[model samples]
Target: MTTRMNEYKQQIITDFNSRINYDNEFRYRFAKPLIELAQLKPGQRVLDVATGTGIVAIAAAKIVGDAGYVLGVDISTGMLAQAQRKVELEKLQNIELLEADADDLNFDDNSFDVIFCSAAIAYLTDVFTSLCQWYRFLNTGGIVAFSCFAETAHTASILFREKAQIYGITVPNPNATLGNPEKCQYLLQQVGFQNIKVVTQQFGFYLNDAESAWNANANSAYGYQVFQLPPDKLAQLKTEYIAEIHASSTEQGFWHDVNSLFVFARKS
Candidate 1:
């Protein structure tokens, strides 16, 4: 990647980690599902791919306890640094965080007992290739779980694109393929995973009053324009974006129409 692209990616990670607070509500509502999918057990070595902010890794460490170990890997140095700091603050020696790309993981085959990827899957350059590589890293019967927004899931992507249009910035593909839950199942099976399961879920949040919801969409990878926008226009974008949401708010606040898929499979 060019330096500019690398910088942009790093900025997005920094912005996301900076703006969003992963509180109990977020954990129970979102992270918990991914953690449950991890199926972590004591004394099991696990890896968290694209572990932004180390939330899943931290949760896994608690589940695996001291007997097992959890390692989180991400591509952004800044993000990894923040995750490492959080791990240290928690004094979790059982968990390790590293800077690495999901597309090219550096580990031996059959090394991990469980592998999990959270919302980060969409950012991967090749989702299937990464799935195959991660599958190779899992032990026989090892489980791999990944979650992504379903294509039909509607939330802020539309708002983001509309805002981008106002800014004259052409954003690259969001990298998130929300299109086909079945495709996720097929990829796992093709990669030699058996007992494949694909589940879809809907979680509604009051976007009218939630700051995290707004920031998660505006500052995350979904909001590419936020990263590319010049400093002068950032405040404008933020203002207009928030206004856009409030403008549509009703008595219950704006409802976020989010649909996600959780795919689980085990290496044969």
Candidate 2:
């Protein structure tokens, strides 16, 4: 990996380790639909990359049954700890959680029957490099499925970037690349994947209030933009962001829609 890429990986590992470990009610929402796109069968070996808390991995293990095995890998020790605990608690003998980097995975070529990633692909600094590696690791006729935030997914980041522009600040959002169907398909095709398909899901949840909204934004990759401001400017930025969410709020609560792009590709 290039120095730049390695640096970004470390940044991602640090930022995500805290919030995603025990995401009981929130991100776990994507597990079923993301795995359904895989079309997995019994006794098939599966790999779940960046498997935060093993949501996708554990779900796959159930479908694969005892004859099959599922490996859930992540760079965060904290995340793997949570995943291991969940797997053990559920008595899922077929699922294994490992602390490993997704970009430079160390697995034999053509080993896995299915590879899945959920809401974690954007953190990969080099998309093509990693997808090519996944293609190599997947067995012939194997399937690869993953979910990424659709272009319109992160409304806070949209507001962050929008508001920042007025203050002469430019927020960088790498997640935007996989937001739409066209971009997702083009990347998969470049890596020699066929039968490429995308399913769009709109998962809108209600935040209790503006504080809840701000905390959600601070926990994800959007936090980078939140922290970019100087200490003096940060207070002002927070005030603006809180109001941004409140402005979009209704009498019940603040509403945020999470659009997920579930992409599936085949190796054959």
Candidate 3:
């Protein structure tokens, strides 16, 4: 990762944290699959890495019942605050929230029965390094599950790349950690995770109208690159992107599509 890429990613995280409220729509679209992939069991010890607003942690707490425990970790304090509030509101004593970097967890070896990461994997500067840490955290026979946006499934990202070319904005190369399932598999194998399996799925959000489409993009990773542009240019980009979405939408509504891959592996 070059300095340029790191800067770009920081800007993205900052913008996304600011704009995207944890709504029911987001939980249904992103958290549902992650929960399913986690295959949680009662009395299991689960670690929710990059836990964001704590949706998956909360879900895991329920699935694991009173005997189980869920630990949620995130780098962003704001996101963790929201997660803690949810914990308090739900009176969930089993879930613990912490502010920690995913790549370098401060825990003893083989501490967790299962570890789960969601869309935050794409933002990792070195996903392989983080995956290695996760591998170390799992007890023997324990599994690690995560969901990431597959590069193949991100139509908006591709569209943004094309648009960046047309507009002469010097957007950096796509993050190496993004939506490529084959590469992800190889990285997992390299980290000594066995019985690896990867599955791809598509989720589409049909915006109520063009305005809703604009709002979603503005709050998402795809739009972060163009977010800091001058107001007029930003407006122009939004308008053009909205038009592109409207033109490509299905009968349901304007479609914002992303490809997410579920990966599961074990420390042998």
**Best candidate (score: TM-score):** 2
User: Can you write out model 1's per-residue Cα lDDT over 1-268, one digit (the tens) per residue?
Assistant: 8886676666556765563344356544677787776678899999998887787888899889999999999876666766788888998989988877677786899999999888778787677788888888899989998787776555555665677778887545443454566777667777788888777788756665545555666666556456567888976877777787788888888777777787788899
What is the lDDT for 219 in model 3? Answer: 53
Cα-lDDT of candidate 1: 0.75
How well is each residue in 80-190 modelled by candidate 3, as lDDT tens digits? 888888899999989999987665677788899999987778766678888888888889988898887765555555566567557666444344464577877898989
lDDT of 2 by residue, 1-268 (tens): 6874565566677666775536766666777788777888899999999998788898899999999999999988878888888888999989888888887797899999999988888877678889999999999999999988877766666776777666666656757778799998998999999999999888877766677566655555545555656887877877888887788878866666687788999997
Q: Model 2: which ten-residue window has the lowest total lDDT?
A: 217-226
Local accuracy by lDDT, each model: 0.75, 0.81, 0.76
Candidate 2: lDDT of 120?
A: 83
Q: Give all TM-scores, in the order shown.
A: 0.80, 0.91, 0.84
Ranking the candidates on TM-score from highest down gives 2, 3, 1
